[model samples]
Target chain A: MSKVMVVTSGKGGVGKTTSCASLGAALAQAGRNVVVVDFDVGLRNLDLVMGAERRVVFDLVNVVQGDAKLPQALIRDKRIDTLSLLPASQTRDKDALTEEGVGRVIDELREKFDWIVCDSPAGIDKGATLAMRFADLAVVVANPEVSSVRDSDRIIGLLDSKTRRAESGEAMEKHLLLTRLDAARAARGEMMKVEDVLEVLAIPLLGTVAESPDVLTASNLGCPITLHSPTSPAARAYTAAARKLLGETVTVTPAREKRGFMSLLFGKKAVLQ
Target chain B: MSILNFFSRNRSAPVARERLQLLLAHERTLAGKSDLVALLQREVLGVIARHIAIDPDKVIVKLDETGHVSTLEIDIEVPEGALARG
Candidate 1:
């Protein structure tokens, strides 16, 4: 059966878009047909992150409103054969996503794709709710900070109460992807450790993405981090998370500190004198 | 242990977790209280309407909790002499 998962965070700037792009690419690289849909209507960035910015002709709004067909709006990735992107409109507001319209679009996608990853917008408003309304599982992205964790807690609450599965009294599966973790700072007690975050949120840990400049570089280059720098710590963590999501019994490991040139360039302390 | 606790005062996760626990508990209690109040309001309005004339919209039900005890406050507005006429 096809599954719809939402990459969401209650607060903005916590890497939901990045997680969606990376996880989508990783799943497609594993030979599954995956489409990452951008639900952040006005501030559409999934196409840019997926390096398909110039190729967007018809967006999700067009598909939902029946102005364009699904194949016409779906942007197939040039790098990965199985990956696609359903871009959101940059001009329309959240109200453009009507319940019936979104339902139709999602149903069409469900029939065509193996997995649908919805990149939810920040906040607990109509846009966020609509993004997660039909989700079977949720990847709740959070940073290792108090505000981020608290916001994730709120998103977890919404996932339990506001989803179709929740309304039907079925449990909605949720996994926590902790991003932007600084191991050095966490050791110094400046940030929350992975265990602490899991304890506070009370959810299963998907994986931890270490703080890396490669992430910013990849995004700036308009490519998913996994495709851009497949060997980086962040990319590896995302790949492992994808593998775990596929029900593979892999050991969950913490993100490693970068070595070689990466450590020299972005490392906290100099590796050399 | 005291010194360690003092140094850990700036740790933000514990504070956030504590605050969320309180807020979520309060919100849940308030939700249940509101549902109960709605039921009570409907029943009380039905009984009062049989004996007297009052504005149904003007009835108010409030729940206040202190420690383990809770106080239920109700106020219903009736026109002057409506009760006497009943």
Candidate 2:
């Protein structure tokens, strides 16, 4: 059965798009059929991040407006054959996306793919709510910061209350994807430690993506770090996160501290090294 | 500067408390001292109100943030004669 996973964080710039692209590609690379859908509307960026902007002749809005068929709007990755993208329209307003319209698209996607990864826009708005309405699981992407963790807490509360499964009193599998962790910084007590964030959020850890230029380098190339810079630390982090999401057990290493004992106490996150 | 920089917008700052302060501010403007003091006072008053009849206007709440060593100081003025019997 297909699983709908919404990558959301009420706070912005927490690498939601990057995680979506990387996780989707990683899962597809693992031979699973995955479709990453951009739900950001107006600001549609997943295509830009995925390096498929120019190839997008139609998008989610086009499909919803009945201007194009689903398959017509679906763009198969030229590089990763198993992965595909359902881009969002840069012209349509967020209001143009209806609950029923999105539901239909997700249902169709569910019938065809193993995973439908939705890249949600930031904040607790209609777009964000709808993007997560049908998610069977969620990746609450958060940066190792107090504000991000707090906002993620709000998003997590919504995931447990606003989702269909939640509405029906069913538990939705949720995971935490803590990104942009700087070991030296975290160790120095400069950044919110993973343990602190985990204690506050109280969710199972998936994997941690360090703050690294390889992420920017891959973004410039419009590819996932896993694809553009597979050997980089950030890429390995995303790959491990992807593996964990697929029900595999993987231990996440703690980032070293530059000024503190994050590394000494928790140990360097073995996978990052 | 390491101690003072905590809670700044600068990403180079070192101190989890500073990061926490900066992050809390990002989510809401009311996280500042004055705003938080007022909020804390209101909550404290409500809690005290449930237990006894007292004048809330005399309630005092102080949050001292000195180099990340924060301590909450609160004083709730009991209605003039309420404490006399106790």
Candidate 1, clashing residue pairs? Answer: none
Model 2 has a clash total of: 11
What is the lDDT for A212 in model 2?
80
CA deviation > 4 Å runs, candidate 1: A257-273, B1-86
TM-score of 1: 0.80
Against the native complex, each candidate's DockQ, computed on alpha carbons, is 0.16, 0.09
Please give, for residues B1-86, the per-residue lDDT of candidate 2 as tens digits. Answer: 34444435343323554555555444333232566798889988998888778777889888666565768899876766776766
lDDT of 1 at B86: 55
Return the lDDT, model 1, position B56. Answer: 90
Regions of candidate 2 where Cα sits further than 4 Å from its true position: A255-273, B1-86
Best by TM-score: 1
**Best by the DockQ measure:** 1
* C-alpha lDDT of all candidate models, in order: 0.86, 0.82
Candidate 1 lDDT by residue in tens digits, A108-142: 99999999999999999988999999999999999
* Model 1: how far residue A122 lies from native, Å: 0.6
Task: State the lDDT of candidate 2 residue by residue for A1-273, as single tens digits.
Answer: 899999999999999999999999999988899999999999988998899999999999988878899999999999999899999989888899888988998999999899999999999998899999999999999997767887887788789878899999999889998888876655444566676677667788887877888899889999988999887878888888888888887776544324334344543342332
